[model samples]
Target: MRTAYSVETVRAAERSLMARLAEGALMQRAAAGLAAACAQLLRRVYGSRLVLLVGSGDNGGDALYAGARLARRGAGVTAVLLAPERTHQGGLAALRGAGGTVVPGGPESVGAAEEAIRRADLVVDGIVGIGGKGGLRPDAARLAALVGQSRAAVVAVDLPSGVEADTGEVLGPAVRADLTVTFGTHKPALLIDPAREYAGSVRLVDIGLELPGQAELEALQHADVAALLPLPQAESDKYRRGVVGIAAGSARYPGAAVLAVSGALRGGAGAVRYVGPAGEAVIARFPETLVSDTGPAKAGRVQAWVVGPGVGDDAATVAEVLGADVPVLVDADGLRLADRDTVRGRGAPTVMTPHAGEAAALLGVSREEVEGARLAAVRELAARYRATVLLKGSTTLVADAGGGPVLVNATGTPWLATAGSGDVLSGLSGSLLASGLSARDAAGAAAYLHGLAGRYAADGAPAGAHDVANAVPEAWRDVRG
Candidate 1:
């Protein structure tokens, strides 16, 4: 798992490292890493031109020092000082000592800088960092706007200028970076949305900062995800391994049941038992699924239950499923009918997966609000329902109740947004739950594998629901390998 520290945590860690290092050691380390990254951007560094958008803080100091390094390597480097008088003296001196020059800042100066940027291979953004309050200052904002329209590749120093280092919220215009070289630890903004969208690619540079407490947010790596997956044992039987019971669909919408069963069959569960009016359709599509029209109460025993994909607003079915004493996954129409008190009181672990539209309904907010700050929305949902919550979108985020690390899913193609994809995800996650994975792990792994399956199904072309479902086994095999 990749750990993300909040701005406050980053500040604390910086302080700890600062105490142990010599004067200006931390900045030097940051500058050196920044310089290396910039050098890589300019393939033939010897004759390439580099532009630095210098501000009035340590961020500018980093850019200046990096410019000095580039100048030393025979790259022509220029620093456009946003705050001429207040710029870091040490950094300025270092740049001049290495044959780099600093220029004034204004519309005419910005035009000259833009010309330099257009001719240069890369632009180093040092306009702001963790100390920034809201967006870019007007002058900085204008320069960033021009850079966005330029051909030069933009590299951010520490964090992207104009992006909230803490909340991942963009108060106003923000610089779009092709790559961001961060220091000490990962900032929450780098992993979350809005700000994350601006950060094209992120690379961490170790500054030896010691952080305390738990990570506010995180993303699971391939190995970490593999470890969380359920592996069948030799002695395990269908019953012993785990059984997943799904209560989904109605005669009106039978596809939901089929899609849900499709995912459940490919998920980690040893067996999947389907109970609903769509049993005939599910069985028609997937002959392996065990079918029953009995209520959830009489669906026999199951290690976990997945309720409501197309069951609609049927109050009766919702109540019966929620009353079960096992891990449960609630999705689609089920979200609308859920009660916080009942979900909170359930003895078993509950995972709620909702798209932005559904989440908007549950939170009494607009879909725009949820999409703008997906991390915050997921965390809020988890805390509100007192259950594990998975918010699905461009970035799928899973958050657990009582404050735990939030996992962000970075995989998946635009094609995964097709119809019934979510149903497949719900069933897959329910199967993992039956197989005894925690709600957080089940949701995250499901999202990851579902995306992989979608990619396989599409292969760069448009695909139908069944295509994605059919690719699950192959995706699973690849992940296992």
Candidate 2:
């Protein structure tokens, strides 16, 4: 599990670690890590021009010290100091002592910085950190614009400035970095998004901050999710494992039935029973699936059920699925049609999967609001509906009804945004549920696997739903092995 602590927790941890060390020790450790990362980036590009956008805080100190390291290593290094008087004194002295030049921020400074950035092999962003509030100041904003417009690889010190370190909220404009080398533990913003989106790739730099309190947020990496995946024993048979009942697809959208069943087939379920009008189409695509035209109650001994996903706006189907005594996964059209109380009152585990748009509809908010505060949105949904909620998108988040550990799925690709992809995820998650995983684990594990399958199917090329489904077994093997 990748843990993310809140900003206050991080600060306290930093204080604890700093108190044990001599003055400048923590900063030196951070600077060394930053400098090493810069060297690696420089080696890849095969050039020596490096520019540091310095602010007035310790973040700037980190950059200036790093700049000194590069200057000593045969690289041309320069610093564009946003606050000349308030610059980190030790860092400034180190840079100047190492033959690095510090330029004031202005039109001249901007011109020089932009020119250097255009020709530079890498740019280091130190404009802001956990101490910063709101968006970038005008000068820092202008510098960020230049960095964004430049072709040089940009590495952020700590985090991309202007992003809320606590909430992953971009209050206004922010820097988009190619790599972010964060000190100590991971910040919630680095793992969640709109801030996470700005943070292209995150690398944690251990400064030995002894953080306080439990993690505010968490993400499941490959190994973490791999451990959570369901595995069967040699004595296990189809009925003995688990059976997943799929109540999806109406006559209007029969393709949803096919896609949802396809996902369940690879979801680690012992067997899948399809119930509803689209059973014919589901059977046509997956003849191995046990098909029935009966209601969810007559679907016959299912360990779990997947509801919604192209089932149209049928109130009856929603009612039947909700009334069942097993764990139910609500998705797609079911999100709009189902009753929250009925779902909650079922007394069984319930998992709701909704993309930003669908989640917005469920919460009576705008999609932008949901995207801006995805962590809060998912948590709120889980609390409100008293069910496990999975908000699917670039960064998929799974939260339990009681506000337990929230798991973020980081394996998604833009290619997985195609239609019917969500249906597959719902089926896969339902299968995990049938296989006896908790709602939160099932949802998170399914998202991780679904994303891996999507990436494998695309393989850097464009892929459709069928390609994603076809890659599921391979993805499972890769994880289980």
Candidate 3:
């Protein structure tokens, strides 16, 4: 798993490590790593033009020191000091000694900074660090805007300036980097959205700081997914493994039932017992499915239930599923139809999957608000509903009501956004829940597989919902391998 810590946790870890090391030793280690990554990006270091956007804090010191290292290797480096008086003296001296030129920041030197940015091969953004709040100041913001006009590749130190490291919020102007070289640990901003979009490709540099406690967010890697996957044992049978009850679709949208059943079949569930008005369509598509037009109560014994994929205007079915003793996954129309009191009163685990628009509706906020502040939205929903919420978007986040690290799905293609795709995901996750995974685990694992399947199905081309559902087994095998 790729774990990310909050700004407070990273700062505490840095302080702990700094106290044990020599004054300049820690900076030197960070600078060395930064220089190495720059060299690799530049390919040919000699005679290359490097511009360092130096600010007032240790972040600026890191850039200055790294620039000095590059200058020693015959690269022409310039350090544009945003705060001349407060700049790191040791880093400034090192840069000057290594033949790097320094330019003052502000209105007087704005033209000079713009010229340097224009002519640079690479620009190192050290204007702000993890502790930075809101956005860049005028002097830095002006220079940041120029970066987009230039052809130069921008590399940020630690994180892009002007983005909140903890919340991933971009209040104002922020630096967009081609690559970000982060030290010690990954910050939540690097993994979460709006800010994540600014950080193009991230490279972690180990500065030898040991982080403690639980991570704020985690992205499951292949190994982590493989471990979470429910593989059948030697004596396993359909009934012994688990049964998933899917209460989806209506006479109006029978395709939703077919697609959900398609996904459930590949979810490692022992048997799929489906209930609702689209039973005929589901049986026709997947003959193995135990179809019933009755309510969830008459759907036989099921370990878990996935309700409300395409059950339009069928609020009763959603309410019935919530009352079940087993875990239940609420999605699509169900999110709007299910009673909050009934959901909160349920003793069994409940997972709510909502896209930004749906999530916005649930929270009584605008879609823009939910999309802009995804971390806050997901957490708030989970807490308010007293359930696990899987906020699906560019970055899929699964948060539990218990307040632990949110699971971020790092897989999938943009092509996954199609009609009925979310239905497939709902069914797959519900099956995992039936297979005995916790609400959080089931949601996270299902998202991981669903995303991977989308990638496999779409392969740089447009893929339909059925293609995504059909590719689930391949995604599972790939994870296992």
Candidate that would win on lDDT = 3
Worst 10 residues of 2 by lDDT: 40-49
Off by over 4 Å in 2: 44-47
Ranking by lDDT: 3, 2, 1
Clashes of each: 0, 0, 0
- Per-residue lDDT of model 2, residues 1-481, tens digit only: 7888887888888888888999999999999999999898778423388889999899999999999988988788889988898999999999999888878876666777778778877889998879787989888898889888888899999999999997888998889999999988888889887899899888899887777668887787778778888788999999878999998998899988889999999999999999989977888889899998878888799999999988888879888988888899999989999998898787889999999999999899999999999999999999999999999988999998887657887887999999889989999999999999999889988998999999999999999887898899988888877
Per-residue lDDT of candidate 3, residues 1-481 (tens digit): 8889998888899889999998999999999999999999999999999999999988999999999999999999999989999999999999999999999978898888889999999999999988898899998998999987899999999999999999888998999999999999899999989999999999999999899999999999899989988988999999878999999998889888888888888898999999988888898889999998778898799999999988998998999999999999999989999999998889999999999999999999999999989999999999999999999998999999999999998797799999999999999999999999999999999999999999999999999999999999999999999
Estimated TM-score per prediction?
0.97, 0.96, 0.99
Query: How does residue 29 of candidate 1 score in lDDT?
Result: 98
TM-score of 2: 0.96
Q: Top TM-score: which candidate number?
A: 3
User: Model 3 misses residue 294 by how many Å?
Assistant: 1.8
Reference-based lDDT, each prediction: 0.88, 0.89, 0.93
